[model samples]
Target: MAEIISDLRQDDVEDTVPGGIAADRLRSIIERIEKLEEERKARGDDISQVFAEAKGAGFDVKAIKQLLRIRKQTTEEVEQLENLVDLYRHALGM
Candidate 1:
């Protein structure tokens, strides 16, 4: 998919938006997105570092990661997930 996109020709490029936005506006939007993507990569690295440190401190990193994931969900969502897990476990005779 990426290879196909990278192979796009100059003639294949067209301003599809109504009124055809300015090139400068398009360039600015792309630059902003690139910047945010770089920041996101950095944040992901930082998160990995934190997880490594937790493991080094003799913490159960896997359980801690699960707790962090569950904390991000709403109460109703967590209940639903738990219910699904219980149902699946029971079905498998676990």
Candidate 2:
């Protein structure tokens, strides 16, 4: 894949000026970024499949997502968020 890109941009690589941008280096960076983007999409799809499986097993997907979000936070942050929710609920007479 990289070889094909390099072959197509051979002219750009050869025509690079001294002290100017390096075409080959730039192409390498762009190719790496594109590869990472593809991997990220694949991982996203995998996560969606897992969530679907959880839903099929009769788990509350929304609560699972909330748990995931809370797990990423500090304990103190979770406490603070819970306190705020309680305060709002009290204010609303709930």
- The number of the candidate with the highest TM-score is 2
TM per prediction: 0.65, 0.80
Alpha-carbon lDDT, every model: 0.81, 0.85
The CA lDDT at 63 in model 1 is: 99
lDDT tens string, model 1, 1-94?
4564445445435742454344555677799999999999999999999999999999999999899999999999999999999999999999
Q: Supply candidate 1's per-residue lDDT for 86.
A: 100
Model 1 misplaced stretches (Cα beyond 4 Å):
1-21
Q: Model 2, 73: alpha-carbon shift in Å? A: 0.7
| lDDT score for residue 28 of model 1 | 71
Q: State the number of backbone clashes in model 1.
A: 0
